[model samples]
Target: MDVAEGPSSSSVVSEQTIEAGHTLLLKMPTGDVRPHKIEKDTTVNLGKFGSFHANHLIGQPYGLTYDIVDKSLKVVPPRPIQEVEDTEATNELINDGEFVQPLTSEEIEELKKQGLPADEIVKRQIEQHANYQLKTEYSKEKYKKRKVAKYSKGFSTVIPALYNVCEYWFNKDATRLRDIRPDALSQILNLASIRPGGRYLCVDDASGIVVTGILQRLAGEGRLITICDIESPPAYPCMVQMNFPKEHTAVISSLNWATADEDYTPIVASSEPPTGKFKSEGQKSRLNKRKVASDMLMRHREELFAGEFDGLVIASQYDPWSILERLYPYLGGSASIVVHSPQVQILSDLHAKLRDLPGYLGPSLTEGFLRRYQVLPGRTHPTMNTSGTGGFILHAIKVYDDPNASSVMAHRQKAKKAKLEAEANANAAPATSSAEPERPVSDETLAETTQPIESSDAAMES
Candidate 1:
């Protein structure tokens, strides 16, 4: 992040060591404005205006514009560029590291509200790296002359939590998680059948892991019933209380009955104080058996045996059949939303449970392993094989409201219809004019149409 720059303040087109993404926000003497995205090994073009060596841009000053001179950007000797690092641009920025997300809900909604297709909105966010900020710095300038030149203008705001979701999901390593669009989210939720006003639950045994993205998605939709064990005073990530919309939140405490107001369900737990390590398969099995027993022993765990949610997010060690053993029955066919991650134990548990269920929608959980969702860092590489983009996410929903539920089939039909509608928009497209001229058919077409059928007599003659 060290940026060294111009020999002196008056120097025009002086070089600075510009890190990729660290923009040179500046006003130049000649009034040529540019926000240069630092690139490695590539020379930039300013046209008859001028160009500069990518390395030279590293140490440029903020609020100072570099004028293009005689078709090339001016260069100053190796002036030490002061390294600039914004925590907002580092730890907090979505897609700066593992995975990526660039667009915001408000931004996508604005595009949709403005009549953009979900795909187009997503494409735009990806291509232009657009986010929730409405006014581009270019848009903020008083004069139109500089608006295009000084394109940094936009509706700027703090880095958002959903941006993280986009990062993890897309793993593009962009300065923004560019592809997390409303339409895609709408598809995912609708596909999961997370109805408005219906309760959504997330078991946050993973702490500040991948579940944050899932919870954020649910919270964005509407009513949510978040389930988590209070290993600490407040189990859920503080990001929710701080970032999620308040009216959409509903706090449900399901803890020990010995404690007051224990109206609850034991949605999460660990067998051996949830240690982070298990050296061998035997050790893993022993701990798992104890985990299963503990998870099962939780007071009236069977009360949650039936499926009861529009959606459910469970993270940490997937107990395979063990976790679902207590939860699937409660799904009672109403479980339209379910998501999990690489917690192998949970996948194993769910895989077994689905085998018993009438209609389980999943790839073969019996064989192979979970695929790591890949991600790209917005910045350059620290080294190869290490990615900011890569992880796992498993999703499902139980449609059976009854053990003998024939209605599950009906539910699926409706769900398919809803997905089709959401995905394949049925709105009218621009029409072709009746007066438009048409091209004539070719002679080959006429010959093909004119070819005679062979009767028995014609065959004999031939």
Candidate 2:
């Protein structure tokens, strides 16, 4: 949390413990003032100022302001969650630009004639082949948004680079995943200690596109793979065979205790709600009309993922916070790499949690891009924007942790003899103390952080 004292208002913030529920902000820096009806799991952007998790600040001592540096917020001034009128209308207006009905009947028939439901088909394509989906999803929404003003421009035009990025996301094709050279993959893979015969599991929402790409890239070195999903793939079975031999591919019907042979190809499926909004509280989580509690999900997860995996990857676009909490434990022994969008808050939060694990790309992973793309820290909500929709990738490797008596003593020796060295010499003081907190100025930095959107308006003009 920080204090931004301006001509009109002054503020302070207090950070509550992790998982403390929503974040609350009091405007006017006064008593119990809240923006009308705070939205749940919602983002409160203070414009040119800051934004924060509306839920996390609940129960905090009153009077707080939060900063949305990058995409995550640091609660400087904190207060309990205030009841606000639901902002559903505003949110829908923002998201839909103009709300359109779900897919129409004729469109649904066309999609079914080709394969499964239109939405499911697009979802699966996104997973199996993101590039294909990116090029195609525009057609899916064309009809629904026909009456809406503007929005006619394709979300992503048929730029060859766009397709290039999508194809590149999948396994083992260096030419496809542009910008990331072979050397980078080798370094990351080497650091991960991945070798032939390593058991790998991936849970990505982008059509298993990235996970499958990893598998193909590491093929023939004796790698074992597994996948967990809540939705079925449309062309997945065939896609797998076409990519890798059927002998290597194994799709498990259950994410529970049901097991596959020790050695198998990568598993695949969607993490969508099979039924209901909220289920029983279980290790796993699902949101729908029917909510299952967290416990049931956990029981299912333990039953399925009790075994060892050399590496784990998360690619779900929704609920990254919940997903990481559920999956991090499984990678307790080995390093778990979380790849997500910058807009995803958990990625940054995860980086913060792994404070001890030195030298992660997490700290500066997107620092360059953020410093380049997302400028102002207040107004940039580009396509990959963070006003509750954009996301970013975060990587953390879980390694063994055992209290070695000697090591603990060795490291703590400095703090143990804890001398109050001097009045003004605290190493714990933040580096930006006297220096003005530098805001990004470069167009590249601004571009990197605004959102991961392809050129639309710029191209249309050209």
Candidate 3:
């Protein structure tokens, strides 16, 4: 069987519409998003709202809203949210009861069975509502929105970019991502200075949320070496969910912490040809797999040992200081180092530790707080609920640690102290020495006495 290759450079650049096997997000009318992989001739099930054939979405541009009509999808313009104005209507006489809507469950189900459109069903319910008219304009709008959220059979296509993936995972299970919000992840990328063609070292224990962000920013360029656990392979469920193309994922290389040590030797693949045929096809396949794994491991080990990474980004369960101690040497001079942790205390401790360490500068501990807002016209305000704390980030820069420079600075400080001491001693002796006739010092003697000190100071300064 022939295997398919990844998109070419031009295609990758120009491709915008959804394609078969592309993973995309579906944002339902209820403001819920679901990840879906497009497959031809398959049906995508959206519970309560309905299901639609996946082919209808294929080749379609993203951000288009589709309404299910007779089990088929049709592009529909999004509902416009009108600016609600103040009105005299009040809820004083309005009764809040289950019977406020005259439409019964049986009737609604019957309407659904009859294949009535969601909009039509909602309109009928509104007409039958007992207190909808008695409420204010804002309340009426809110009521309609609630009904729409429940009955609307429409969804919009969303691109599974880094932001979208982070948001989806965060909303679904924030703990799974170590509570790293989208804003926090963005900050990490910025602090680490992640860019194309730059090599980065990452220790992501947040199920690949950090790794995914790094790779997405790399955009199919540069290298990302992630450290994983010794026992198991790196688990990047979040990255896998993004469904990146082969070229984009090709830059990622991973090795276990145990193998990252200098003393650990990776098994290299033999260059010699095979001497005999395999006993069976399965045996040959297994042997080939082993060879491939061995070669990849060796290559990754070499890439890591050959240091000078552009940046280091870590979101791990291990002690941040320990990780920094082990991987600090790999970072290039002036390389950005960013460590993310769910607990601020840990990062705060790390921040203080980095301050006293050589070669680390401007260590800062920061926590990101993200609050969403409802941007509706004439009703703009912060959302009722917001995420508490994403996480804390400890950022610092790694510089060249020159032993000679440090020694020279120390000598200069020592010489300056000695000079101050000698001046003090001379000032005390001057009063006693003034009583006797002091012999005039010759120019050559004075120059010789001070020349050594001046030369030494200049050498230390230089």
Candidate 4:
């Protein structure tokens, strides 16, 4: 199947065609979202909602709601009102103890077995409910919604943007993706300066989540070299679901962590090709596989050795410094390096180390706190039981050694020392009293002045 190429780096903000090989989030009638890869001519079973041919969804616009009607596909009409207004709120709620429906589970099963239409089945159940009249309009709407979620055979297709993909994994298996929330991932991407046509070296141990985020930002424009162990190749289930074209995915190259820096001495290139005379079929197949592995190793290792990648992004279990120390040399001058860890201490230690290093600048540690809210008009408030932290990130940039920087730094140190000394001197100096000093009269001047004042007083008395 010929999958369409994804939008360019600048054009992906808009919607595109839903083609085969594209990863899409299927929103079930019950509001459950599942990420699925669109393979051509495949059957997708939505369990109780029944199954549909994958081809039935091809060419449909994303966010289009589809319904399975009488074993055929149909587009669900858009609702006139997208949301229930706060004015529609009602106080009545059906108690869980109340089983208002007259139909038993067996009767519902019997109706389902008769191949009755889903809507017809739901309508029957609603009509049979004992509290059907007691329900307020809002309660009735809620009841119908609950029933539709169970009996409806429909789904909404959503374009799985990076945020959607992350949310899906977070809801499904957060531990698998290292709990790197979408907001945290965004910070990493922005701090790392991920851009189109830039080459990046990455350590993705978060089930390829980090890899996917980097790839999406690059938008099929640059090479993203990933470091992986031989035992576990960087296989992200999320990435497999994305419908990115072969060329876009080809930009993500992997190098074995152990042999990332090793010279690619191609043993396969030196070995003679297997001959029919000496090789059995099985042996020949093994030889071909070995050659393929060798070639792949050589290709990735050559790229690893090539001068300076644009950035380094690591999300791994190993010590961030250990990984950085090994890969730091390969980063270009002024390249952004971002390390993410769930534990704060690891990043704290890394920050202390990187900040003092000559080749790096401002290794600041930061974390993201996301608080979700129920955004209803009248009763909007923060959602209960929401996760507070995605993870912690350590962001820094690689720097080149500058001989003149030492002198500049020395000058700054001297200026700082002088300023400090000047402050100390000012503080140490004693305060002088501003009051007028008493003038001491000399003995002769004081006697003459007193004698004149006394003569003037005597004359005045006479």
Candidate 5:
């Protein structure tokens, strides 16, 4: 096993430790998923399934599947069980569910009110079923899955990957995310050439979906400057849910585009001391937070004016061309620019504008077409419902804008002319006599030459 390199100061949850405040993906036995923020000193209630102390999850490795066990319903690894036998005898026992042991709603409610263990309740229900012994091993497995979905008190902790979060948001509300599907987001990352150690300028108006997606590629190793035009920073609901470490989150610098050209200083402390001792602790805490926020703002401003960015990504409601026209100047040579929009007309106009622009290469518009398939034995086909459009994307690379455009073009023409002339000279010149003796060194050649030490020393000795 390999040892951990070191610890990071950011509050983001690492793979090894699920700390408090970290958002996790809790998957139910029914294949349903939901996001749960790990609050300190509180119980995470999963409704009918059960509840576990938030502290119970802290310090646990991510992606570990835990089963709710015992009276208090503590989380623990599931106990190993024997695999089901798939014999012909068991297959012959399959029964249709037309009529079975019918239990009234009140009876089921009474069983639940008794607080009986889920396994015990399931066993009792199976025993009461009229066709209990008639189920094939496969049928029994299917029955168990249904019961587990209804009564199991267990969940698996999943690392909230950017892709997963995007997928979750797509499921939750595609419209809010600008209709950016997971596959579409993947294409955006690819087209933008997002990677570690890159400096990116982003217009993340989609609640930090683009920001978090970029961070996944950066992997806590790059700079992200998010430009917004608002009084308060845009609420990155999705990014906050990811709980990126303060250090990694530190990489993301937010700036108001209105003041991006202006310089400002951070307020270190209040000029006037507390007027009275009546100020509560909450007020003092709020003051300190403001100071910290001011300092962060100053830092982000410093970085924004520092240098050109490696890439520009926009997933905003603003006109893509307008945003790019203003920001394209800040992109370094060969920098990629990617714009995502649900409508085709926006990209179509942007494509025309980019073509007219001088310092862009291959400004093309592309669409991400995705279709999922359901694969199972004897039941494999394209899923019935698929997103009609993942959205249109525009990609282009920045190029050096030559100050002397005419001069540069003239120079290229002259060089080509020189090359052709030289080739003509080589071909038209009289063939060199291969048998011609080499030319003897003339006075000009001898004047430029330095005799070897061996010959000079012999001459001097003589």
Candidate 6:
């Protein structure tokens, strides 16, 4: 029989271009990123930067900067990041007053109304400034950057990768993601050992940010069984925002917490097909859809109950210990485990509890800290305002502990020693009439006698 093949690398690589209907992250001049869906022949409004036709960006590559002119976008070369040398200027005699610039707010607004470009407006402001000449090179560049951020009509198209998506949400509302920074999310993926073709069990309550990261890492080749509440569907808004391909999303299957019990049984759908035709095509289609959905749910439930998942990851609001206790049995031996929470106390408690568990190993609690910096010649320093804590993570591995392991090992050793002693006695003794009755050992008997004894406890643990 012929086997099926997965999608080619080229098909996945084609996503590098900005295509129609693909979700994109527009990074504005002020270091703000906004998500927008591209459509054919539509206008994308960029607020103060102005608006541009969506069709203009349909086939362009990402990471390219564009300038808005006449309500249209034009490709512009990216500015090179270089170090600025210090000049023989000091701020000792600089004035600290607000009226240092002759140009007023009304004049700037008039310049904008006259359709004058942002660069021209900034140039006029610099020319009108009373103390522009006395500023150092670094200070002058900083001033220009600030003015550009305020009035520049330029934006860059950012691909919706994991890091970019995390950054967008982190900047917009860190609370939504429980303050999971990009670095912290990356660390979680690494700690969990997320990879393609690995099965994982996840319980995410951070708007599916954790789930989304797993799916991206899986790359359309793994099973992700998400545990959720029975009352509602999984709230994975971040996953939806990612706009992943159908193959990537298909690997996700959800199991409710109530039904995850080993003793709990689901309501099985009838195996027999409908006997008669429906009154209308629409009715038949609806019935068929429901049947298909039911079948999928039953299959997913069976898979979950079968157990032996590769790893487990949890970022839920529920008690971490309780969640781990329930799902611990499903993981295979030596499987990686990771749990995340915004509060360090929660993970600290879980870490302590895991130490006492029989089938856990090396449980550790960690918190990630990230800081940004401004690099320039003789002017490099960490940014004044940086992200706080990205929350804490608890990572560990699962192992099997057999109750009868020691006893079984002892019994095997005793049997081997006794056999060795008997062989030594026989060699020491001379051949006698009683030995003459010993028949030649057949190949089957010899094989059985030489075969090593295996412990049932060890087999089950594996």
User: 1-462 in candidate 5: lDDT tens per residue?
Assistant: 345757665545454478787888888766678889887889888876677777888878777777665423345666565466764545454445543535666776688777766666778888777776666665676676577567667888766777778888877788778888899899889888889999999998776888888887887888988889786667888886576766677677777666454444443466223784527777777777876776677767767766589999998899887787667767888999999888899889888777766687778888888888966444468999888877888898898866554443345556776786787854333323322223444566575565444557658888
Whole-structure CA lDDT of model 4: 0.75
| Displacement of the residue 337 alpha carbon in candidate 4, Å | 0.7
lDDT of 6 by residue, 1-462 (tens): 334565567765676788888888898998888888899999999988889899899888878899988778888886777677677998766867742656788998889888887778888999998788788877888887788678888799887789988888888888889888899899999988999999999998888899999999998998999999764468688875577888898899888887676677767555434676576778777778878877887788788878899999998889988898789988999999998899998988887777777678778888897888877667779999898889998898998976554443345556666676787853232223221113444578788778776768879678
Question: How much is 282 displaced in model 2, in angstroms?
Answer: 38
| Pairs in clash, predicted candidate 3 | none
Per-residue alpha-carbon lDDT of candidate 3 for residues 1-462, written as tens digits (9 for 90 to 100): 344664456665434578898878889988898888789999988988899888888888777888887668989976687878879998788766743667888999899888787768889998887777788888777877787678788798876678888999999998988889999999999999999998999999998999999888898999999998865567798986577778888899888888888887755655333777677777777788878888878778888989999999989889988998889988899999999898988888887778776689778888887778899877889999888879988888998765454343345556766786787753221122121223444678777776656457658888
Candidate 1 Cα deviation (angstroms), residue 183? 14
lDDT winner between 2 and 6, please give it.
6
| 10 residues in a row with least lDDT, candidate 4 | 428-437
- By summed lDDT, the worst window of 10 consecutive residues in model 1 runs over 150-159
Error of 4 at 368 (Å): 1.7
TM-score of each: 0.34, 0.33, 0.82, 0.74, 0.68, 0.82
Computed on alpha carbons, the lDDT of every model, listed in order, comes to 0.42, 0.39, 0.82, 0.75, 0.74, 0.82
Tell me the spans in candidate 5 whose CA falls farther than 4 Å from its real position. 1-14, 70-101, 115-144, 261-307, 371-389, 401-462
lDDT of 4 by residue, 1-462 (tens): 435664455334333568887778888988798777788999888787778899988777777888876555888788663354334334455567685667787998888778776668779998888666665655666667687677777788877677777877777777777778889888888888889899999898787888888888787798888887764466767675556656668778776766685643433452235353536667667777877787777777878887489899888888888899889988888999999988898899888777667778767788888988966434468987887568899888788866453343345556776787787854332223212223444678687766646457668889
On TM-score, the stronger of 2 and 6 is 6
Query: Which portions of model 4 show Cα errors greater than 4 Å?
Result: 1-24, 35-42, 80-96, 99-103, 111-140, 231-233, 262-269, 272-296, 376-379, 403-462
Model 2: residues >4 Å from true position, as ranges?
A: 1-165, 168-195, 218-242, 250-304, 342-346, 356-364, 367-391, 403-462
By lDDT, the candidates rank as 6, 3, 4, 5, 1, 2
lDDT of 5: 0.74
Report how far off residue 268 is in candidate 5 (Å): 14
